[model samples]
Target: MKVSRLVALLIRRSPFRAMMLAALIAVCSVVFSLVSELSRVSTEGLDAAIFQDNGYLGTYSVSLAGVPLTIEDQFDVVDRAAESLDMSVWRYSEVLPEVESECPPFDQVGRRSLQVMWERPGVPAELDFGHIEGVNAEWCIDGQSIPKDALFAPSSDEEAIYGAQLYIDPAYANLVALSTTDPITYGFYVVSGREDDQVDALRFAVLDEVASLAEASGYAPSVVIGRVDSAEVNVRDAADGIALVYDLIRWGVLLLAGLALMTVQMLSARQRGWFQGLLIALGAGRARVVALVALDTAIVAVAGLVLAVITLGALSDPVASFAEQSLQVQARSLSATSLVPLGFGIASVAAIAAVGPALMVVRRDPLAVLEAPRD
Candidate 1:
């Protein structure tokens, strides 16, 4: 019989064992996949509630909704800052709504005006806004019924490192893009006042000043002071936790897969000692016997991995939904890239599991088995 058919026949010898092995593979695959996706969502989902690069401790944002037409007039309102308070500014000019969106925390920083153009989706998220950091305004979707399919920024992928790029789309609405050139935008003001009460008083004082200017200038100012979400709300700060999870997944999969496959294969090989002796006596080289044994284990490993992948595909969506609702994240993607490591891990474990069985079958003497009494 061909090695392939022979291997298949051998596996069929123990239906109960095969069933047990299949179950193990499926369960582990589901757990590993779900945990990984949850981790990604947890990290990415948080930013919509809070922003990165808060300018200074106790800093808060002051956004002016009804922006003046000319840049100089806009400057006039902010020129009246109290001597004790330090301030920085960024202006919004274009607000091409991706769907239904709100401002980002970084958009509150000042940058050089871009002498640029937007040819319909020209920029990838707040890209038109130059590099500036340390703002106090944090955005939240608390009350807004953000659509289920809304696309979000600070992408869940590796691209999140650079704070500039924003994923732009008209899916539903998760994030808003603000550039210095955007006309209907807020004036991001950085002001110092850590405590809520202190910031509230400062904001009220500014609003009062703007109201006073409105009476004299004939143009009423519309402004609101917003607070940046504090460190308490930040989720990414728990770097150690994420690292621990990754380590657990890696080690756990390796140890479980290796030991389980090795246990089964070694037991089967030791039981078939007389059969192995017959093959050797039939002129099959020790190396050939070992190769055949390794091939048998390889088939089992492939079967386990295949079962795992199929189960993952069937269940990823439901699992993602549960996670999304429970965790409240904007995204939960099961990227294909995550599988690369898993595949390698399985192969490594299978190879280690196959070795003991192959070595035992190869090293045993064919003549001794015939002379020995049957157990």
Candidate 2:
């Protein structure tokens, strides 16, 4: 029988089973490809957040190596680094509980208050909010000091900011024109998530750079870097998570590809023994006979791969967009280069599986198989 005819018959024997395996392969391919692309993009954005120590609000904690927090001595270096890295340096408000600062509490600052929508009046608002919407509610700070509490509708007016001590994001800091040394305390904690990890490395690099700069500037200063309770994430944790997930996916899909396709192919091969025996009887070489099976497997694999590619195209954007919104980071476009290895691997497995049964078929005797005299 011709190779094309054999392949057609092989497929016709169990079309749905073949299609089901193909679909499974496609689902695996799409998932792996999408995850790989997301990881690459997430890594890129997170790397900058780790090194620069500002922007991307989800960053659990930022590590500053050296140069001291809120110190005017290293302002030049900090400024230069900020310029070079194209990053904004954030200064934490020193107004912690029981700490007195000359630079008025955020409550004393120009109109910083919380606004929210309530069905009725007199719903006691929580003094401190875990949500940003708390910025709109009226709260009594300290004793008998309800700083400018008014029941007005939510408007985009600047008067909404009626509180005294808000976390000094870059914009708020700039608006106040506060000096770094004006008791406007900055908290530059060394984030050592993993000992000797990337996060630690970034912190060390910062320390080294500042030390070198201080020495060069003819100032051998005593600088101490300490840790604070900042409940933020380090980039290394994310990397570990991605690696663990990838490993799980790779093994799971490999098992599916092997068991599903290989088993189906083996069952189908049983029905084609007469056809294969005919080929060998008609002077077809073992290599040629095996090629026929490989070609048939290739056809199925190609179909699966195409389905996978199409599914990936359809899902990648939506998944990426969801991640970007959910995680609050830039979800870059999927990279084409990531698929090369995956495609090659799928093809290799299909070829190997096809050749397994072909080897058996090529050695069988056509006339004896047809006679069925021996079990």
User: Against the unseen true structure, what C-alpha lDDT does each candidate score?
Assistant: 0.55, 0.52
| Window of ten residues with lowest summed lDDT in model 1 | 112-121
Q: Give the candidate number with the greatest lDDT.
A: 1
Q: Estimate each model's TM-score.
A: 0.52, 0.48
- Model 1 alpha-carbon miss at residue 368, Å: 2.3
Give per-residue CA lDDT, model 1, range 8-109, as digits (tens): 777788777766766665566556666666656654444433344332335455555443435344444543442235543332223343232244542343
* RMSD each, Å: 15.6, 11.6
**Structure candidate 1, residue pairs in collision:** 55-134, 58-194, 92-182, 93-181, 93-182, 93-183, 94-182, 94-183, 125-166
- Let me know the TM-score candidate 2 reaches against the reference structure: 0.48
Model 2 lDDT per residue over 148-228, tens place: 233222222211222223332222222233222232333332222333333343344445557766666665544333333
